[model samples]
Target: MVDGGGAIQRTTAQFEGPRERLLCLGPAALRTDELLACIMQSGNGKQSVYEISTKLLQYVGGVYALADIDVAELLSVPGIGRAKALQIAAAVELGRRIVHKPSDQRLQIRTADDAATYVMDRMRYLKKEHFVTLLLDTKHRLIGEDTSSIGSLDASIVHPREVFRFAIRRSASAILCVHNHPSGDPSPSSEDIAVTRRLEEAGRVLGIEVLDHIVIGDGRYVSLRAAGYMDN
Candidate 1:
């Protein structure tokens, strides 16, 4: 009997669990850690790729933050080589672009969520505020999207004359003003409200309807029209 003295015990078969399930199934079935492992491909001989991935996620703050990281920063991780970093960065850019594309032909802006979904991916990643105007034809189809201004975080100046000039040039029947708030809050500020009002009044005189002014945050947004700020 080895009750008092320590004994070397023979190990049984390894228990198959979540981690094994992740490796056996695929990246799609895996958690964030498992997905990172697929990107890493391999790790130092001392640790498995999944173990290395878990440590990297902890260092980077999480998967969401990891998505925002550049190649240089990702390469800084112990197990991530330059090649792996580039692969991850490329995957992120692909995902970002895919989210911005609308699969269907319908261009209707039926709700605030619809407007936000259209602009969030494009604007959220931008470092500076971009004031863009989406010109729509009478059928609510997108004619064009133009960047009116790019400026510092606080605000981007917009002139009604310049805005209408583009609208008239494009022969757009209606317009949707879109701008990003880098602060990641979709709530409209006083200045935001003021700008929307100015654009609405200008559109009234120009015979071009201003359908909405949308403010895009990181993953959220606000539609001035839907909030009853614009007079339809």
Candidate 2:
């Protein structure tokens, strides 16, 4: 192609889309929209995959926000159909599982900070609250973890039986409770304190210690024990 300055430009360079760029420079070099486009695979007749992917991101706010959206919501986007929506949802779920997956090396939750850091990435981007239990062995190393309840935007209905049932099953000597605030603020609600105290009392009866309750925010975390909420 000839530019206004009469300089010959490589037309091929201009035609290189995300796939070509990804092949040349790797996925890490592609922008968020480009990555989404690759997952989408194709676009509607009138629009390019790049345009569709960009619109999808804008509609949901951002790439991180995609994690919270379901297939029904994805269908509302201009160029996304059932197939594309399913593909995108699957991709998001896979990403979530990968982040939440346990490592080959067992993780030890020696302190509240350790527990918070362990669940931070998995919980931080969620749109709804999740009450998760970190079941720790005698040495405070993670033996297993489970989500006790997934609830509304602000609350999870957690019962001591549900929480301890999983702990007893896993043979956990101590439990670290973790949950997230979709609002991105780690401040403890009155309900949070009440629930923690309830769990602590239950733990005492079961002879299992409640180490702490860690509230996860956007990138911040608050340890209820450190904040004096777990004092006897």
Candidate 3:
């Protein structure tokens, strides 16, 4: 790599690939297409990296659509093959891990609001009801969080077994049951209270305490324990 004066213009000697732009100007400087090109490396040789990446984006609609796509769908792009499709899928998964990875400090859920705060960032805007459980240690520190079921329009549809499987396996001392209402109403339905009571009884048998059942809505929540439903 040399310059017009026969001197070493090593940094700028050759073409400006996505990697080089990223190095010189940082990630924020790169456009969406440039970032995709970086992941894609180079084209199938018939087209440039930018062109192929743009075409791929067009085929998939957008980067947002990439989240739900699998290997086979990634291969639908004209110039994309197994290697390219796999690289994209792997990158998406890696990004997802980064986004959802918990904080270094162990999460503690003392109240329903605390538990809601821990999950609201991810669960807030969901299009369907998601029943989730937070497994807690003896100290009430969060050990794990799991989605027990999705599209649960009614609480009765969410069985106690599905909610407690991991808590039993992990030997969790207590658990918090939380679910989002897509309708954005945090008010607890009669069925919600019934399910919570049922789960509390089931937990009593298993030696796991059902601490609270929190129903999430649009920036609001209701705690069954707080409402005197769980005290009985």
Candidate 4:
């Protein structure tokens, strides 16, 4: 007797509601294209969800490649519109964060390099400026992180109140600030220096030490403290 092995046909001939299939077999059992089709939920007038997902996977080379795919690239595909593209992007980001999330013990930030490396993968590719604060315990172990601001950084938008709110809640002994430059240049502007100084002052008043301010670029980073901008 001979046996044939082929791809599992988990759903009906018409591609519909892998949601029910997922509920029965769980996510791990579904194929990658099927999983993507589930995330998209529906397709455009021209194609079915499954066909669009297969095209997307082929265009990007594979599922892991989606990690580095930008919205423009996703939109370039035949059936992917802004809404579906954003949905896929959001799902990808959530999965990335979850994978990088620490286990039993919290990760520590011991130096400027450590801080920058921790956030580089998460913030490096953002299209706009994102100001995030790393809350730390006495030993400098990371306790929490807050994305306090999402637009261009300035005194008003990256205000002291928003920056330190999460730190206070977590009772963090110190904070290391991180933000990304969409232009992929880590050079500190005058505003960047001014913002660091202001944050340091606020940290003093609030009894939370401002350890460093790291500016993340494409694959590079600049630590404000290392550059003497935080000497005062």
lDDT of 2 at 89: 98
Give lDDT tens digits, candidate 1, residues 12-45.
Answer: 2321344455545655776887676666677678
Error of 2 at 226 (Å): 1.2
Off by over 4 Å in 4: 1-38, 48-90, 152-156
Task: Write down the lDDT that model 2 would get.
Answer: 0.89
Model with the higher lDDT, candidate 3 or 4: 4
Ranking by lDDT: 2, 4, 3, 1
Q: Report the poorest 10 consecutive residues by lDDT, candidate 2.
A: 8-17
Q: Tens-digit lDDT track for model 2 on 94-191? A: 98888778788889888887888888887898888899999989988999988999998888888999999999988899999999999999999999
Pairwise lDDT winner, candidates 2 and 4:
2
Q: What is the lDDT of residue 86 in candidate 2?
A: 96
Error of 4 at 201 (Å): 0.9
lDDT (Cα, 0-100) at 137 in candidate 1 = 89
Number of the top candidate by lDDT?
A: 2
lDDT of each: 0.77, 0.89, 0.83, 0.86
lDDT of 4 at 147: 89
Give RMSD (Å) of candidate 1 vs. truth. 8.2
